[model samples]
Target chain A: MLDFLSEFPSLGRRDLSALRQWIDEGFRTFSRAYGEQLEAFFNPLLRFLVWFQDLLTDAPWPLVILAIAALTWFGARSWKITGGTIVAFLLIGIFDMWEDTMATLAMISVATVLCIAIGIPLGILMARWDRAQSVITPILDVMQTIPSFVYLIPVVMLLGIGKVPGLLAVCIYAIPPIVRLTNLGIRLVDREVMEAAEAFGASYRQKLWGVQIPLALPNIFAGVNQTIMMALSMVVIASMIGVQGLGVPVLRAISNQYLALGLMNGLAIVALAIIFDRVSQTYGKRLQAYRETGRD
Target chain B: MTEEEPKVRIKSLYKIFGDTPKVALSHVQAGMSKSELLEQKGHVLGLRDINLDIPGRKIQVIMGLSGSGKSTLIRHLNRLIEPTSGEIWVDGEDVLAMNDKALRDLRRFRMSMVFQKFGLLPHRTVQENVEYGLGIQDVDQGEAAERAKKWIDRVGLAGFEGHYPGQLSGGMQQRVGLARALATDAEILLMDEAFSALDPLIRTDMQTILLELQEELHKTIIFITHDLDEALRIGDRIAILRDGEIIQASDPQDILMNPADAYITDFIKDVNRAKVVRMRSIMGPAAPAQGAPVAVSDTIEEALQKLHAAPDGCCPVMAGDEIRGTVGIDAAIQALKAPAAAGAHYS
Candidate 1:
């Protein structure tokens, strides 16, 4: 009895190995059959990603910096944040990491946009139905908690090592916060307010766009900020699959033991994260200014 | 009063709140009590056999304490809360039988409601909130804005149109709520405890505003309240509900003089009868009195004030140009006292 207890009965090694072999072979067959169609399905996304990266890198450096400064100013509405962002970008440029910074910025932006475009509707669906929530919540849990390398194998197997697979890997990691936050935000809308909309004969579409979505904006913006941060963190990991960015230098530095190279690229990523977080947070706060002010 | 059809009619209305409402409804119909139903079947009896006919263009007040289901009953008029069993007829159309499109039209074009919590969209300005109902109906943007502005001005919120509801006082937010409802120009206005959240002074002011608007608009209004004073002040016809059942419904003066049950008597026991009892209710047969005439419309309190200066203790009550009866100080005092005990339930 003691021996059995200590050993802990489990699947036999032969059975476990056979199960693993079966899964690997099944996945290989599926990929071999669907690989061409899957590539065609993602061609437009690939073209868009390439075009966006080219736009960021091929543009004159001054124009790019000015555009980022203007976007920061528009979002934060604060001169301090805009000035800090400008200085951060200039520092990256002076350190000769401008090209890599731009490439990473493009990648993170596209990933975030794609996540929101897909995740928000899925989140809304979850908020509408308990069945959908129960089903999707577990899948999102796996996406969020599973090791990045585990999913990387399947994604790489399906799409091969390139920008698309890397983008897919980053999105898998970054999308959960957005989807969860959006579901929470929409579900948290006041019941009385929604009833008022219905009492006035608002259609389903009207209630969503006019009342629910507007009220949920601050929370949705929070989700976006979180998604951007998670995407940025995945940059180095994503670079291992051939996606180009500041992650490339960091990866090189890791393999070659070059301290300066790793430090500069890592700091550039940190600077980018700070600028995105501050601008988005300030904008979110601005959206709820009405709630903060005292009665007139 | 001229004989005319009521604008809204309800018959055999019942509401049961639970997963198996139809089953619970059968038990309630078979005479199960409210608490008994809740205890035995885990179902709440929301309203039981509600039948009422609301006349056109009048303020019909439904008075009840919290949990009396006055809000639930009013929502049935617009079908916001579907009934377990009932028939609702508004202006000759069957409300319960309406399909989705018809119900939408009914709510959009015929009825509008003002909520107790002032459910103005917090993200929207007062102007945008007021325009919401019209926007839902697909009205022209410029036209909707102009109409919304008119109501915003009408409700005394013109200057605050650009402000968000969160930046306003409770009274101001309710004004926005009122303006939003009225801007739709729906003939039926349902006010579910619309003034209950305001301070007493603000509540009184809002009551006066509603009365003044009703005088001109003559919209068919259903007002819900827990305060007897508010019901007496504004209700053309008052219905008193308790435990999901209406114990009494009649003219305001009739309810004050002749309460239908012990619960109603207890409900009105603390009310200052002099303020609510009209001279018309207490006046005697048409007889010449040795004092100045008082308007039949005056309350007992107002008549007493007038009698204080009269040489004689009695005064003639005039309906218009002619005396309808006389009311003496003794009769006025008698009217102020509570009715004789009608039930042994209350100590």
Candidate 2:
């Protein structure tokens, strides 16, 4: 019986080599035809990202540290958080990696902002239309489940390996969580509240802005936090494509077997992650607490 | 009372829920039961042919248990739930045919709703929640704020304007809901189980507050409730629904005294009729009687109390001091013989 089953040529003996070759050839031709146009479409955004990164890195280290610490204070509303943020930034500076840290922050900021700007509307559309959700879901699933490095390959092939390709890879890797969470957030809005809004004659725009978005804020903020963390995690991988950041030190240390340098830079990355996490988590918790207990 | 025109008229309204309700509607109209429709075609008969004329400047209460389509009927007034086939007229304008802009205008300018769940926006203060309808109407912010404050105070939430709905008790949150609806000053108010979420005592207090407000405002109010007592207390006219069909619709006394069918009869079997039936129902032909007359509007309970001190155990049933008829001990005793009134506590 086993021999008979194995004798079916298309079963165990079947090979996917031909299908793989066709897919590879098709992708290569498609990219050769449309790659330039795609890059042209994204050029302005890439330029803006580069300009923003340069502006931040060129700013005085003390001023940048002061501003970040102040922003953390504003969001977290905690002296402890503000102090921690200052200490974290100062540690990066002490390790002679202040510029690299700023570069990484710039990359994460640009990627996170773009992700939110693009992801939230798509998510809202998904929430509003079943068709859009169905169409986008499988795409999001693929984007999230694939190895993060896989994103860099096509991006590099199309844009040809630089800060732009690296940033694009980071964005592709980080966007799905925000989109999924945003859709979930909007869908989770209280049905009674939406009915009340509709009953009160709220227009589509009014309902979206006044009711759904306000209630979805905590969840959306959580998504942003996750996106930022994901973007940061991609820093070292992004360095493989020549985007200069704190990850460069780590990569250099790996090849040179320099333990102290790798450990210091790695700790700096962790510090940045902790600072971003605490600030965003605190802000999200405040919103949730207000919803639960009427205290803000 | 003055004879008011109908503010909201629903003509032959039907709502069927499914992928294709128009196909299922024929079976429903041909007397298929709700369960039969659900079982046979996978379509839920949300409402059967419902016809009603809600009078202007009066409270029209639609009462039923859950799944009776009372809430669905109220939603149809605002066109929140589109009917499978029907016509709804609000203020003599065809609401069903209004375009989106006109419908929005109708909602913003003509009607406001109070919800059973309060539905206060959690992110906003009580004051902001009250200001919502005005904001949607594009009222000037200052004027909107002034009006919102007035209604907030009128609903007896003067100092809690800054508090959120989460900070308030159920009754207090409903007051905020009341304030929000009233702040819009929409001529027609749709209250869907507005007090059903409150405790019994709080619900009674809310009913009193509504009646008092209605006395002064005289806004056209369509209220939905499952509680019979609340319906009787607040409704000038009542419509009772069962399984998506109207069993009977009449004044409180008519409903209590002569139920239209067995279902309605069983419904009123537990009701205290003395408090609902008026002196006019049991009064005899006009005749010379002993003591000060009791008003025709007085409940039978009041007439009995008035007869207690009457010299001849008789009194005139007076409408504004014009004697309509006389009520003696015989008629009073007969009225008291109502099945549920004999030993039931008035409260």
Please name the candidate that would achieve the greatest DockQ relative to the true structure.
Answer: 1
Off by over 4 Å in 2: A1-4, A7-22, A286-289, A292-296, B1-4, B339-347
Candidate 1 per-residue lDDT, tens place, A58-119, comes to 99999999999999999999999999999999999999998899889999999999999999
**Stretch of 10 with least lDDT, candidate 2 chain B:** B338-347
Instruction: Residues B272-307, candidate 1: write the lDDT tens digits.
Output: 998889999999997757777899989988888767
* Poorest 10 consecutive residues by lDDT, candidate 1 chain A: A287-296
Provide the overall lDDT of each model, using Cα atoms, as 2-decimal numbers. Answer: 0.93, 0.88
DockQ of each: 0.66, 0.58
- Identify the runs in model 1 with alpha carbons over 4 angstroms from their true place: A1-4, B308-312
Candidate 1 docking band = medium
Chain A TM-score, prediction 1: 0.97
